[model samples]
Target: MQVILCEDIDKIGVAGETKSVSEGFARNFLLPKGLAYPATPGNLKKWESEKHLREIKLVKNLESARTLAAQLESVALSVPARAGREGQLFGSITTAAVAEALLGKGFSVDRKTIDISAPIKTLGAHEVTIRLHSQVEARLKVEVVSS
Candidate 1:
């Protein structure tokens, strides 16, 4: 069966993509969950138009993300955490903490967008990558110091 994806599906495809899948899967899973619609002629046309608009929006968002990235590059964020004598924190600093630090620096970064692979265990300076958009990424210097 042919279906148009209404949202991004991991291991499948992005929104507005038309793809073929098993009829049972399309009807039972994707359609019921509102993740996709049957790729009829009307729906396909609608999807095409929606895809064009989404592309334009994505371009504008990417430009804004680039500007934000530039601003983030110039600022260093400090995170205060409880640490031992060896400068190892009792609990690691997570992306949520980084996002909070960014907020303190006047950047409204979403925690989901701040890509910290693992929590910072040792207290020191670390570079964290913030994914502002699919194409725009920025490095933020995070200084973890004792409180």
Candidate 2:
């Protein structure tokens, strides 16, 4: 039986793909689970249009991420913390703090998206990586100064 996959099936086919399966599998499993639809002429036409729209949306999203990454590169952020005479900070800078600082500067970023490999514990410029998207990463400079 010929069917159109509505969702990806591991080891089988991806969404928006047409595949041929055994009659029992198509009728009993795929149809009942809504993983696929019968590859009729009408369904095929609808899937093609939808797949084209999906591709356009993906391209737009990638463009948006790239622009954000470029903008972030020019951004300079600071965090104030109390430090000793030797310049070791009393407290540490965290991902939440970085997000808050970004929010203060008109950029709303999630804390989880700020990838801090280790807690910042010194009084100097630190490198922070912001994973804006799977394909985009922005290196942010966080300068820690004496409060």
Candidate 3:
């Protein structure tokens, strides 16, 4: 089955894209959830017009994300946590904490955007990646210290 995506779906495609999928999956999941529509001739034409509008909106959003990424690049966040005598933190620093720190610095970034491969356990400086867009990524410095 062919369908037009109305929003970005991980492992699938982005909005305004036409993709093929199993008929059962399309009919039972995507179409009912409003994530996509059947790729009929009328819908395809509609998607063509919507694509231009979506492109413009995405461009603006990407620009904003880039600006935020630039601000984030210069920030050094300090995360304080309880630690043991060996300097290992009692609990690991998570992406949620990183996102909160970024929020404290005036950036409205989601936790999903933070790409921490592993939980931060030691008390020291670390580099983390913040994904602003598919093509825009920024590195942030995080310093973990004893509270």
Candidate 4:
């Protein structure tokens, strides 16, 4: 039996894959478990149409990411933190803190999207990378100062 996988199945196939399996296996395991559907003409056509639509949506999302990246480049973020005798921060400037600061500055950003190799422990100007999309990234200037 020919089947189109709806979701991944270990040792069998991944989603959007077309595979040939035993009729008994298809009827008993794959179909009953809602893991796959019969590879009919209508289903294939529908899948192709959905795939095209998804590609268009992804392109639009990528464009939006790029647009955001451009706007973020000129926006310098200042984060206020308590420090000790030295300029070193008491704790650290984290991604969440940076995201919050950006939000305060009227730029919405997700904490998880802020990529920091190391926590900002010292106070100074730091360049941070913000991942808006897998292909789109923005360089952010962050200045940490004593509150």
**Local accuracy of candidate 2 as per-residue lDDT tens digits, 107-135:** 88889889887889998899999987656
Q: List where candidate 2 sits over 4 angstroms from the true fold.
A: 1-49
Model 4 pairs whose backbones collide: none
- Which TM-score value belongs to model 4? 0.70
Best-to-worst lDDT order? 3, 4, 2, 1
Highest TM-score, which number? 3
Give the TM-scores of the predictions, in the order they appear: 0.79, 0.66, 0.86, 0.70
Between candidates 1 and 3, the TM-score winner: 3
**Considering TM-score, which of the candidate structures 1 and 2 is the better prediction for this target?**
1
- Model 3: residues >4 Å from true position, as ranges? 23-34
Candidate 1 per-residue lDDT, tens place, 1-147, comes to 989988767678877888899999998899999999999999888877787788888789889999999999999789999999999899899988999888888888889877776779999999899987766799988999999
Q: Cα RMSD (Å) between model 1 and the true structure?
A: 3.1
- TM-score winner between 1 and 4, please give it: 1
Tens digits of per-residue lDDT, candidate 3, 1-147, equal 999998878799988889999999998999999999999999998888777788998999899889888888988899888999899999899998898888787888889979887779999999899988876899999999999
Expressed as tens digits, the lDDT of each residue in 14-61 for candidate 4 is 667899999999999999999988999999888777877767777898
**lDDT (C-alpha) at residue 106 in model 4:** 90
lDDT of 4: 0.89
Error of 3 at 121 (Å): 0.9
Q: Candidate 3, TM-score vs. the true structure?
A: 0.86
